[model samples]
Target: MKYFGTDGIRGEYGGEHVNEAFFEGLGAAVSAHLQGKIKGRLPKIAIAGDTRFSSEPLKAAFCKGLRGVEVADFGVVPTPALAFGVLKEKADFGVMITASHNPYTDNGIKFFDENARKASDEAQEQIEKFFDEKISGSGAEASVKKVDMKSHYIAKMGSILPKGCLKGLKIALDCANGATAGISGEVLRGYGAEVVEIGISPDGKNINCNIGSEHPEALARLVKDSGAFIGLAHDGDGDRLVVCDENANKIAGECVMGLIAIEASRQNALKGGAIVTTIQSNVGMDESLKKRGVEVFRSGVGDRLVMRLMLEKGCEIGGENSGHYIFMDISPCGDGLAAAVKLLSTLLCLKIKVSEMSGVVSLYPSIQKALKVARKTPISETPTLSKTVEKIEREMSGNGRVLIRYSGTENKIRLLVEGKDSALNEKSMAELVKSVENDLQ
Candidate 1:
């Protein structure tokens, strides 16, 4: 809770808190914590990183502090690959160095337990406590071995869909010049799709620069110009995805999940006939799924919380609105490439193009505002804002909803209001933004 954010520990690379010394200390503390948690057994950690100039040095420094631990180094891989490698290698856990959609100057570290899922909050707290205690080690005798998971990950994803499932289909991919720069194309092509690649040339600083899921406009244009059947984009870590239909219409992850829920319902594959998503997801998804005899459950704003609820609620699909779709039927964590493959497979199976399928779910009007705050005062501590939120919810009376929370990675508070009536929703959102500023100021 102290060091980890909604997803992981992220900050500007080379900053005082993110530099080599800090990571080295983190490495020692995490190794100690994991060792204890795993019953005094020697923890075998699978460490992987994305394409950032600072990643390699940080990883080396972190591993340096591991001392005598067995570290399997997966050189330059996606975050999901690191998660999958944890299971594939049967390691005690996994560590990934990436900042997801953050800018190139920023970097992060995410941990996955042996189950190939995000480390539990309690586990993260334990690691943080050890870090604060400043565990000491000789920084020597750490066993760092290199392992290649690219091909293995590719094979596993391909096995999910039928053989030659994407034959004769064309898809465009923007890999964000990060983890999936060269890997996504290889995997998609291996699955028989004609792949057009962009953002594949990573020069360290170019990762996530005007490309990837955060910026899908360029990818949309490419998809339309190249006449590709669909376009998919991934963030820096290749853990989240943004897609474009054949008509260059951008599709949010909520809509993607809705469409998938429909398909799953048709095949009687919807686990417990429910879908899990985040509070940030659109209300339209809820209404659409309800019509299809599926229920939608909301979790906190991270894939970790989504997955946590999925397990608890017996739901098979869960994801955030920021293109982090978790097809629990396939992968444990949010995987851009895996989701794209499944989307393609769905398209082929239904004999429909992305453009035609995009209309399956209509998103309601939603507005989001991010207000700068000097500090992250807990919502409960701000009685005025908390009460206002409750009052607004009462006014909505189940017609819509509101979510206000401080961002885990940024010094700001986000306010989201959604409903069927666009005009009323906008007015309500403006009032909520004012309340956030007043309360947090």
Candidate 2:
């Protein structure tokens, strides 16, 4: 927990845990942990990174820590591609250097097991234990080789949609100047769509700067101005997606998920007749899916938990409101490009506009806010905050909901209030925010 966050180990570049020296030690620790798992032969690791300037140095330092391992270096690929590479190359594990949607000034690392799944909590805890012990290398150098993972990834993604499925569509794509900058454009173009691209040029420092999924105003404008059928924006590491309609309206992530679920149900392909989402997802999506006889299950925030629940429930699809969509049938991890292709395929088959698809779910009015905290006191231990939440829930009279939790990756508390009345939701959120601040103080 000291180094890992909600998704992985992330912080400002050059900070205590993000710097090269610590990465070198982390690499050694990871290697030590793997050595205990694999009995014979050197474990092979597939490593990739995003566009952050510091990623290269950190990757080198980590690679140096591996003792007698074979390294398949897939330079400048998306996080999901590195996971796919892990399976394609039959590697024992995968490592990706990225800070996901974070700014260029930050970077981090994520680990995937041979199953192409995020390292389990148990695996991460063992690695952390090794890191604390300052594990040293066995003095055997890693055999490094450059692998063409991009070509394989592109081929697989491009094949997701039927040939010529996008023959007449004009699609606007913003890659956040990150890992998907080069790859996503190619796949869409190959499918016969005319692609309008921005945020595709990465200068290392420009990634996620006023572009990408985190900031999608530019993509919306591009969709309207270019007369594009739709717009797709990806986060720095290409594990998240944000879509805009032809009218330049950003479709909510929940609506997108609902649209996909409806289509899958129509085709009798929705596994277990269910889908999984995070607690942060709007209740409207659940209502919409329920009308179509599809069940919705909620999990804690984070795609890792969502995926776990999906497996448990035998669901093939799951996502977060923040744009992480996991298609268990395609890949174990969330993949922005794969999600885009799946949605496009649905659109083409249904012959509906992106805006029309969004209309499938009507979201309830909600207000969400995040407040910086001096400390992360457990919410259960904060009596005042707990009482306020209970009071607000009672006031909503089962017509609304309240969710409050500390951010897993930052020193902040996130709060949300959802109800039928927008005005009441706003008032309740203000009161809740005030309560949180007072309790923290």
Candidate 3:
């Protein structure tokens, strides 16, 4: 909690905690950590970022902190690209600068290990501890050089997708005016799809502004109006994905995972016959997979936690409901463009539409509410709320579920209720919300 969150160290750009001085310290900490791992050799660190105006300055400060380290500055690339480059270059690690789907006013910094995995909790803690220490560089001025990784990345993807797999498919894409602006379209075109791109232009201020996976309704409208066969929208950092059918009906991330599972099963590619998801995922996904004899594993929320379970369970796929997906067989981190290509390939191979394929999972009606609270108290310490939640669970029994937890980034408590009956779910949610408010607000 000192410097990281469910995602990363995110705050308002230019704020006290997220400004130049902080990132400079963070950079030095990262350099020292990686240096310790390599035992005094020059550590190589790759960095990339989204299109936010603050990204460049923060990145500069971070690199300046790494005066003695070898920096591969992948200018203005997606978060996944940085992860991929880290592994491809055999660097010690990498960093991504962007607040993901958060508003443009915010920014963040996250690291990936040499294997492209999220930095472990222990590693993050070490970085925080070192932030206060003054570490000398290599006695030379910092010089961050740019690297181009798009061609190599696209070629790797090309090998996985069948030749001309997307031929004649009119695909619509919403790049969210962020990292994937020009990158995603080129990949789809290379696969032989007629790409209809929106949110392709970024003015450094409009990333995810009423666009991207957080607001797929806009892309759905574009899909319907443009008469495209399918639509894909990505969050600002190009790590999340949301899709729409030809009719423009949006498909939830879990539903899309279900569709992928079916294909993987048919091809005997579903390792361990298991899938991993977060507790936030709809229980309907579990029920739907049960019929196919596929086991479901739940981890704490966050893509990092989801991947942890996947690695332990030997599953080939895992993701969150927020559209952050990991096809572990392809990449360690989430890549929205990779997910889009896989979906397209599956459709071609199955000769089915997105609407029909997505129907593989039937979900119960659910409601999610994030209530702003003045403070965050441990749920165990809030007796009133705990008792109320227990009573609600007893009443629901086999009919529904209740999950309440605090947000890591903000002073908010997220409440989710899913049930066989919408009215019952709503009633239970209201009671839980009030209980939480009374105890924490």
Candidate 4:
């Protein structure tokens, strides 16, 4: 927990833990931990990275720490591609050098087991233990091989939908100038859709800057101008997505997930007749899915937790409101391209306009805010904030909810107030924010 966050180990590049020295040590630590798990042969690791300038150097440092291991370098690919490569190669583990939606100034490491699932908390703890020890290598250099994982990943994505399912349709895309730059556009065009793209040019420094899922204003404009049927925006490392309809209206992730859940349920394709989502997801989605006889399971706020709950419930699909959707039938990890393909296929089958898809769920009025703090104080320890939250819940009288928690990845607090009355929700949120700020101060 000291190094790992909600998703992975991330921080500003060149920071204490994100620098080359730490990465080299981490590489050695990971290698050491895997040694005990494998049998005869040496451990193997599949590695890939996004388009950040720091990615290459960081990767080299990580590779240096591996002793007597086979390393496959998939080179500047999306995080999901690295996961896929791990499964295809049957490697002991995989590593992706990225910070996802973070700016180019930040970088991080994500680990996957041979099954292509994100490294669980237990696995990370074992690795951290090894990281604390200065273990010497056997002096046998790591055998590094450069593999072409993009072609295989592209082929897999292109095969998801029926051939030419997107024929004559125009699709707008924003790749965030990161991992999906070349790949997403190529896959969409191959599906017979006329693809218009932006944020596809990665200059290393420009990734996630005023573009991507985190910034969909530009993509919305593009969708309107191009007359595209829908607009898909992917974050820096291509694991997250944001969507907009032809009219340039942005669609919430909850609505997107509801639409997919309903369609999958109708086709009897939804495993366990359920989907796993996070607590952060809107209650409207849960209510809508319930009406259609599809159960919604809520987990903590992370794709890894969502996936874990999905496995527990025997569900085939799970996702977060942040646009990280997982389809166990396709890939263990969230894939933006894969999610986009699923959404398109669902819309095509339903024969509904993207704009009209919003009717699938009617979201309650909500006000959300994030406040940066010098430190993360536990909400339970903050009497003022706790009292304010309880009072707000009592006033709402079960018609709404209040959520307050510190971000697992950043030094900040996130607050959410949702209710039937928009005015009450807004007022309650302001009071909550004031209480949180005062407590922290």
lDDT of each: 0.85, 0.91, 0.86, 0.91
lDDT of 4 by residue, 1-441 (tens): 889989999999999889899999998888887877876889889999999999999999999988868999999999988999999999989999999999999999999998999998999998888888766345487899999999999998898887887999999999999999999999999999999999988999999999999999989999989999999999999998899998999998998888998999999999999999988888988888899999999999988899889999999989998899998888899999989999999998899999888787778878889898776777777878889998999999999999888887778888989889899998899998889778885
**lDDT over C-alpha atoms for residue 95 of model 2:** 98
TM-score, each model?
0.93, 0.97, 0.96, 0.98
Question: How should the candidates be ordered by lDDT, best one leading?
Answer: 2, 4, 3, 1
In candidate 1, what are the lDDT values of residues 344-419, reduced to their tens digit?
7677767877877647777888888889888788887885788878887888788888878888987889888887
What is the Cα-based lDDT of residue 434 in candidate 1? 74
Q: Which stretches of candidate 2 lie over 4 Å from their true place?
A: 137-139
Query: What is the lDDT for 246 in model 4?
Result: 89
Per-residue lDDT of 1-441 in model 3, one digit per residue for the tens? 676999888889988678999998888888778777786468888898899999999999888787567888888888888888998889888899999998999999988999999989988988888886665344344557788876677677777776777888899899999999988888888888899989989999999999999889889989998999999999999998999999999887888887788778889988989889999999999999889888889999988899889999999888888788899878898888878877887787788888886568888889999998987888778968888888878888888888888887767899999888899888888888888878988
Better of 2 and 4 by TM-score: 4
Off by over 4 Å in 1: 39-41, 136-140, 379-398, 434-441
RMSD of each: 2.3, 1.3, 1.7, 1.0
Candidate 3, superposed: residue stretches over 4 Å from native: 134-139
lDDT of 3: 0.86
Report how far off residue 237 is in candidate 4 (Å).
0.5
- Least accurate stretch of 10 residues (summed lDDT) in model 3? 134-143
Name model 4 segments beyond 4 Å from true.
Answer: 136-139
The per-prediction tally of clashing pairs is 0, 0, 0, 0
